[model samples]
Target chain A: MDNLVFERTKGLTKKEFSYCPGCTHGIIHRLVAEVLEELNVLDTAVGVASVGCSVINYEYFDCDMQQAAHGRAPAVATGIKRVNPENTVFTYQGDGDLAAIGTAEIIHAAHRNENISVMFVNNAIFGMTGGQMAPTTLPGQKTTTSQNGRDPYVVGMPIRMSEVLGQIPGAYYVERVSVHNPKHIIKAKKAIKKAFQNQIDGKGFSLVEFISTCPINWRMTPNDSLKWVEDSMIPYYPLGVVKDGDKND
Target chain B: MAKVLMKGNEAMALAAIKGGVDAFFGYPITPQNEIPEYLSRELPKLGKVFVQAESEVAAINMVYGAGGAGARVLTSSSSPGIALKQEGITYMAGSQIPGVIINVMRGGPGLGGIQPSQADYYQVTRGGGNGDYNCIVLAPENVQEAFDLVKESFDLADYYRNPVMIAADGLIGQMMAPVDIDKETPKLDLPEKDWATTGMKNRRTKENKDVDPNIIVSLSLVDTVLEEMNLVLQKKYTHMRENQQRYELINIEDAEIVIVAYGTSSRICRSAMEILKEEGIKVGMIRPITLWPFPEKAFAEIPESVKGLLTVEMSMGQMIDDVKISNNGKLPVGFYGRCGGVIPEPEEIVNAVKDFLGGLNG
Candidate 1:
């Protein structure tokens, strides 16, 4: 008899994903669910869903979930973590939700050294609002809002959030990874696990940023989107550990 | 419990603790800074959470998250800070997460001034935030009532699964009065927060085997679905209007003129009533404790002897709108106000009443 090697993680619900075809959000969700299941924290974990495509993430994650206002997930997660310190708390946010209107919230949350994990998904395009320009959108990347492609002089350069957050003294661990291929997917999962582990260990603040894909928003095929992330996206948003407080210790 | 001298803000903080608040999140704004300061000192001792958030926006969102997670939460601010919190407050209302917010209102229309003002009356009662939602507004006239209302506000919030506002002013926040600090606050019987996002573990295994995972969300994109949800909220509001009307009538049975006011302005109006009574001008007063319910019943029972109505406020006549609406134009209602941190003196209110009485005769 052939032994079963793998199964769906219990951290996910029976509900089907609402993400578009070839969207990397599904892979990111699977990785997070698998991490929570392996860590045995799904039952006690609480997730704050952001306002972008994953606004209905509460339906997908088999944990207590709250849908917060646009770009306010960090502040909401701070409240949850502070109120329920014993429970594992995290926020899942997109590029537009995190790097743009929520800059103050994310910066202050890191400054406060809040005991919560943040999963920052940078897709370089606003997927939910139908391909609008995101704060992390690369220069020359065409978006619905930036129809003529992003202008470096008009909008300034793309925000490197991991590097910006790594400078905060309160941030105990910060890493940026990608999920374009199997090898990179494995690496991204490891970084996500470490981020949650730091929070479980009573560390101050931990953030794991995934360079994700939005094929429909990017106006490309799923395979081309993956290749584009590896080529155009990686060159601009260099991946690797930006700050590892535990490693220093 | 014996009555003890306490500032209104301090009394509110103690009441929050006695009321079993699990978390207090706020940022320092003048006329209400004492609230956060007191909570920071006291909540930690009681094993409750207290955080001075970076901004009023973050503070209200924190309250939103804590309340969503089934924790009793509190956040306090003044006019400018309160303006920053309207976005989160609207979200909480949309999500039906219960929480308590204290607005010790200061001057406004920009960062007007940090002195007492009722300019926030329209903002609080008429829905400061966007969308078709109204938070229950509790206006307290003294330190004792402020303390009592803080505790009651939490109960009302959880009972209705909605946010409640303690709309005191700078005078109430800054002044001191005798109150029963150690009074036994009756633990109100409240419904279990089954709708709260309190983990999916046991809920997943409960009686409803086919129920989806518990989620606290406010985003309803579908038009018909949102309309249905709005109708449900409208029904709740209608119920509150019918059952939650509260007001105090003083000597209205034998008066020729009625003065309408709430919070600090009501106290001032009372002093003015005493002054007018000494002058033999028949003056009665209606102090509304619940602002949103608007105490329309009190207006309905206005004595036949009453010739006119006058509204007293610290701002330039915001609550006057509700007073007019409740009065239904049955009596000529006049307005009296002082803005930009100026408190209306008793003599000014008496003169305004005199003017209204003259207009009645004219």
Candidate 2:
């Protein structure tokens, strides 16, 4: 008899994603779903969706979901975690939502050591709003809002969020991972799993920042977006753990 | 329930505990700071959750999360702070999440003052946030009613599956009054919050079939779906308007002038009525308990002997618009108010009514 070697994770709904053809959000969503299914927390998990490309993610995640206003996901998640202390809570946010409008919410949640997991997706450009300049946009990278190639003299450099968040005493774990290739994708899943695990074990404020691809927004093909993430984004973002409270690694 | 003298803010804190609130998230602001201060000490003792959020914006979003999770949550702030909370309150309204928001209003056009004021009449009644929505706004004129209305707001919020607001002012929040914390504030018969994001652990069927998970969201990308959602919201508001209109009327049978006011301003109007009565002028008052469901019907009950209706407020004539609409041109509605943080004196209101009456007769 042939064994069913693989099947879709129950954490995901049957709906197809609305992401662009080559975006990494689908892959990241799959990984998060797989992690929740594997951890046996699918039924007990609650995901907070942010206002960006993934605002409609509530339709995809099988667990209970909430949609928050732009950049307010962290504060929303804090409310959920505090009220449902036994249930797992996580927020899925992007660069524009987290680094720009939601900076205070994220920093304060980390400062309070709120017991929640945050999946920070950094594509270095605003994807949903047609390639606007993001706080994490590289200094010389071009965007619709920053047409003159992101003037470093005026706009300043890309913000190193992982390092900044790692310095907060409440942030028990912080990491930056990339999904440009299979090898890095595996590493990224490991980091994401650890963040969820930390929350499950009652640890506070674990976040995994995924260096992702925005092919359409980047004005590149799917394959080229992966290559760009590897060649350019990784060099600036540095793929590794910035802080680990467990220090297991 | 033994009666005890308590400040409005402390009474609200005690009422929240008695009201079965599961959690509170708030930021410190003048006029309503006692809410958090009292909750921080009291909620922990009752084993309820309390978090003094870093900002009013965070506090309201926290309310969104807890309320979405099917918990009875609350938050309090003053004028400027409530303005910061508008974004989150709009989300709660859109998502149909149940929560209580206490806005102990102070003066404001920008950080106006911490003194008592009803200047937020436009902000509270007209939907301060960006959206087509109406929160069930309850205005309590005194400290005791502040406690009672706050307790009532939680149940009403859950019953309607919508946000309920207690729009008091600095005076009611700061002044001391007798209250019975153990008073039995009746609970509404609300449907089970099956949509609440409380873990779906028991939702699995005996045959191992999974129910579609609940989602508390407001974003509807499809035009048809969003329009339908808005229609659903409008229907809820219509129901609220029909059933939730409340007001207090006194001596309207033989009055020459009817004074329409609410909250702290109503108290001043009451004082003015007494002064007018002693002067042989028949004056009465209509104090609305629910501001958004603005007691429009009260105008129909106005006696024909009444020459005009006067709106007394602590702002520069914001509620006059509602007063005029409610009167429907049946009577000439005149507005008497003090701007900034100034409270109108009883004598001034009495004199305004005399002048209005004098102009009508002559």
State each model's CA lDDT, in order: 0.90, 0.90
Q: At residue A47, what lDDT does model 2 achieve?
A: 96
Candidate 2, residues B1-362, lDDT tens digits: the string is 68999999899888887788999999999999999999999888888899988899999999999999999999999989989999998889999999999999998889889998888888888867987988999999988888888988889999988999899998998899889777777678889888999777856778867577889998887999989999999999999988889899988888988988999999988888888889899998888999988878777899889889988889989889988998888888888899777888999999999898888887
**Each prediction's TM-score against the native?**
0.97, 0.98
Off by over 4 Å in 1: B184-187, B202-212
- Among all windows of 10 consecutive residues in model 1 chain A, the one with the lowest summed lDDT is A1-10
lDDT, residue A32, candidate 1: 96
Candidate 2, superposed: residue stretches over 4 Å from native: B205-208
lDDT per residue as tens, model 1, B213-243: 5677877889999988888778878878998
How close is each model in CA RMSD to the real structure?
1.7, 1.3
Q: Pick the candidate with the highest lDDT.
A: 2
Q: Alpha carbon lDDT of residue B292, candidate 1?
A: 84
Which consecutive 10 residues in model 2 chain A have the weakest lDDT in total? Answer: A240-249
Give me the chain B TM-score of candidate 2: 0.98
